[model samples]
Target chain A: MIAADGGLGIVATQRAVLTENGPLVLASGAQLPHVEVAYETYGALSPSRDNAVFVCHALTGDAHAAGWHEGARRPGWWDNLIGPGRAVDTDRYFVIAANLLGGCSGTTGPLSIDPATGRPYGADFPALDMADFVSAHRGLLDHLGVDRLHAAVGGSLGGMQVLEWALQEPDRIDRAVLVAASSRLTTENIAFSAVARAAILEDPDFRDGRYFEHGVTPRHGLKVARMMAHITYVSELSLAEKFGHRRDTAGHDKRLAADFEVEHYLQHQGESFLDRFDALSYLHLTRPMDYFDPFGAHQGVVPSTRFELISFDTDWRFPTAHSVRIRDQLAARGAAVEHAELTSPWGHDSFLLEPDGYHDRVRAFLS
Target chain B: MIAADGGLGIVATQRAVLTENGPLVLASGAQLPHVEVAYETYGALSPSRDNAVFVCHALTGDAHAAGWHEGARRPGWWDNLIGPGRAVDTDRYFVIAANLLGGCSGTTGPLSIDPATGRPYGADFPALDMADFVSAHRGLLDHLGVDRLHAAVGGSLGGMQVLEWALQEPDRIDRAVLVAASSRLTTENIAFSAVARAAILEDPDFRDGRYFEHGVTPRHGLKVARMMAHITYVSELSLAEKFGHRRDTAGHDKRLAADFEVEHYLQHQGESFLDRFDALSYLHLTRPMDYFDPFGAHQGVVPSTRFELISFDTDWRFPTAHSVRIRDQLAARGAAVEHAELTSPWGHDSFLLEPDGYHDRVRAFLS
Candidate 1:
């Protein structure tokens, strides 16, 4: 158990192994002999196990969703949303957060050892779809004896999972909150992800995802990938307001050193991301995000599950059009779906930035 | 002279050396002892030399604005708008297109030898500004015996030059056409350029812009930079229509290979750009673009040069707001200015793509 400031004081990320069914078959027809899921519980499971709220995370997020680790100065990525009396309100409901299937945060991913070769899976890790991620989450829920979830909520890539959960097993989730996400990746999304993957792969140290064995990381390539992705995460307005044409006070040296505030900010973001994330994991995870398409086969059908779709006006990544499309799809089938295109200059990251509007919507919908 | 199928049947790039001047003073407070300008001319100069139409090229453009070069498969970059009877009409006006001061083509730039060291300027090249570019063009005009220009026209960075031309020597230019560009770089422009520069600098091969001495090129870094910039050149709608989530027929290799069509397109753009552009020149040119702010010093005053502003609706790089701002500024100062917010899915490159509307407007104004 770990102590946090505002949220559940005690939180622990526990692991579950699913090995009873020989090997788990992935969407790509590959198999994992055994799967290990790392999950954190914010509160005690309800007596009936019906008041459980599952929180999924976006890319770079992990099971540490609401608390402070032993030596950590900052709380989890979504600590602002999940706390004692916050949006999710751990006091009334048991909250569960898990590291994704193709993730680096304590989850069995590319960095994990392969039983057959006694080496990190690396490039050998099977391609996984959103269904595989949901399946692994199901393994954890089944192990915890949770028959049904009160709600499944997430934003961005995490939100993709929330939609997948409702589509894959509607009865399992009573409600779903998908924020700043889309049912499928847009062309722009695929384009951006493609460039990012190229950056990592082109790095000399990458060695076809064998950088770990080479005793070096593809830090330069990964930094470039992060820098490219960071541009899409924030709105132009926000970027203009935050950085603008403002040069670093140090003055321009006419060299490679960052002269603009935005450049310095991007450099910092890229460098910091390398410390916590694995390059291979980023590649593995982003592929499924581009491949996710639950409505591909049933474009005209409306999902029966109740949904709350939220999008920020400034979010060009997953614009309001995506949320509106989902809302219209559900509404077409007479299903209950609420969508709000909230105005925020924070862009796609508005979900994590504006607490009042976003929290209120989540709280009201969840209640 | 080079033969061509359309427009002017024959054209050739000419060079002018400005050695008579002791040194060319730059906005950065540095000096270049000598400067050479590469320029191309179409049609004949009028007896009075007042029928000259000065054409400025964009970031990736060159002095070859119209007509074909010897053994070249394609015509000039602005061939569509500068042909015999086209918008600028080579038959009606003497068109002058000069490579920018810090450009890589045949112009004096980072690749030029520094007389003092007998080595390429590389990182040692003095920082330049828009005014420096205009100064070089002015020198070319003086050498050509052109006293005044009927019009100064350009799009994107070229448009920056057009604005600078009117601002620096208001009496020399009778009119200016600024298309899909602004008087200064926006915050987003600076941010994008910063990332591009960072990508080039971060590459190990860049060698602090001294890669030329090592007989190596920072192609990887330059490619990444081009890929990032290419995304901004087109609209999201255009990208979506041109290259959706359609994957390459060769199947995903689960590696860094281009899977999506957009990835393939960006890779091609990046690779092809490496053959024609220099990394140091890109760095040098993009800096002045960010630092360009002609209105900064003379905000309240608008020169008497006639102005034509064109912006595409989808050009988020230099949105209609930018053109409108310019229009408003010029109009408030009682300058003759015409602004058009045209609708086009091509984004910032619409000025170069939509020949009909853009050319018609230019033809009407210039005629």
Candidate 2:
């Protein structure tokens, strides 16, 4: 536990291995020994300790799930859903959120030091998958002395982890909630991912993903990739409504010169991401999303699991149809499952936003 | 006159001034003395000359609109629609296809040397508009000794030119056919354009638009831009049908390794573009597209004009609704207009690809 500041305690955790196991071989053939995870906890564990809730974040999110950092204007990314009396209700349940295994945010990732050489893993970091990420989380829970979770909730890649945890450790989770998740990467998804990866690889400054030491990062390349990804994150209708070539009259000159406000927004997003994230981490995490299959090696049906799933109607990236596919699989096996296609214009990001009737549905379902 | 093999003769006009009297100034505050247009003519110009037909091409198209080329597998870009018994019916009407003034395909664009400096214009090239482009075409007609045209026909950006001709130069064109066209750039259109421009602008090798003499070209930027543009050119349904997550079993290993076939396709388009086209010309031509407003200053109403418009039901980029908007605008002004939203899965590119129904409609209109 870290020190408290103001009326709120600023909880932080340093990186540490969850298990003393042999090096796990990665999909890319690299081996990782003693994986470490950085996590934070809030509220108190229930009497049964099964009231522990796990929160997973989307792309670019970290373990910091709530509270203010001195002068921070915003609390945490999921501050709306995880605070006391909020949707997840930390008032009654212990909450845990961790940075993924291959993340740059205080987790054992490409930026972490290699014990064998005392150097940053950089590109040498092994490729990861949803199971590998959850395995690290499992280790973290072991360290916390919590054997089971009341619920696991996530969206986007975070949703993939929730699905994985349900399939890999069925008895450990009482509920699994997935939002805007994909069962497997479609060819178009793979195709777009390839474009993003190529954008980085083609950057001469990328230096074979060793730009960290070169005092130069492929910011432009990363920016391009992020811009591409950002487009997929929102729906066309949302884009039309939010950005709609409505020129920002005050800064209209610069806006028109650059094409439009949306372009400028995307450019800023792409450029800013490079400063905070490692390209290697991006490479490692996205690959797993590309290969994820909850049904495992089975070609016909989803893996048997009792689950609760939700998807947005406008999310073209991971549409409602994908969730329905999983629902059908669970139905085929007669496993308990409840799913819904929420109407929202926010696209894949809708799960995180406050919709008119979304909170009530989540509350009723979780209850 | 140039020799066209097989007893066919083609009259080609080289760099003729289209607008010599008070040439319009570009958006960049640069003034051009005269706009130079390059054009080629096939078949005979009728005695009345009313049989003269102007064929407009889409982005990346050229004056080479028909017949075979040496060592080529396919004919000209529009060979299927402009030949002897085809849509435009070259045997009955003299067809005039010109390379736009701000294009790289043999027209006077940024690739052309500025007489003032004896160097490529690069970023110094004047910013143009649809009006400027139409003015240049008018100059071409005057140079060819033609007073008016039976019809001005085009699709996409070319379709924009056709609409401009009908509205701005009403007396010079008896009829106009715009296929898959928008009167002005939508917010979404400008947004996509911004992504493409950013890809080119952010490339270090772009050298602020002076890449030609730097011994390097921003091929990656150009390719990324093209890849982004390609997504807009095809329909989601078409993408789902043609390239849907189906594994190229033989190429699966390669795809799973670094790049997929789709990646290769995008890279090829990006790199090959630099070999044949001028980057500065791309910037120059597309800039005009942003400013194109057939209606008076983007009032969301099409200008009063005599036109028969055609669009594809599946063309989401410029869908049937876009054509209907034009029709509605024309109706408001009591102008004669006809529109048919053809059914095709080819999306925005249907006008260029689906020649069966497309040619039939054109033939009936022309007759």
> In model 1, what lDDT does residue A335 have?
71
Candidate 1 on A215-260: residue-level lDDT in tens? 9998888899898888888988899999877775422234445877
The model with the greatest TM-score is 1
Model 1: DockQ vs. true structure = 0.53
In candidate 1, list every pair of residues with a backbone clash. Answer: none
Q: Mark the regions of model 1 whose C-alpha exceeds 4 Å error after superposition.
A: A1-5, A249-256, A298-302, B1-5, B249-256, B299-301
The numbered model that scores best in DockQ is: 1
lDDT value, residue B311 of candidate 2: 91
Instruction: Provide the lDDT at B229 for model 1.
Output: 88
Encode model 2's per-residue lDDT on A1-367: one tens digit a residue.
Answer: 3224222245454565764766655534457775778788887898778788898877778888775555665666776677666677777678899999889888888878888888887777676766778877887888788998888888888888887777777778888888888777666677677777777777788887778889898777778878888888888888888887655432112222475678778877877787778777777778677667777543344334458888888998888888888777667756688998889988888877886666666666566
Total colliding residue pairs, candidate 1: 0
Candidate DockQ values, in order, are 0.53, 0.41
The CA lDDT at B102 in model 2 is 83
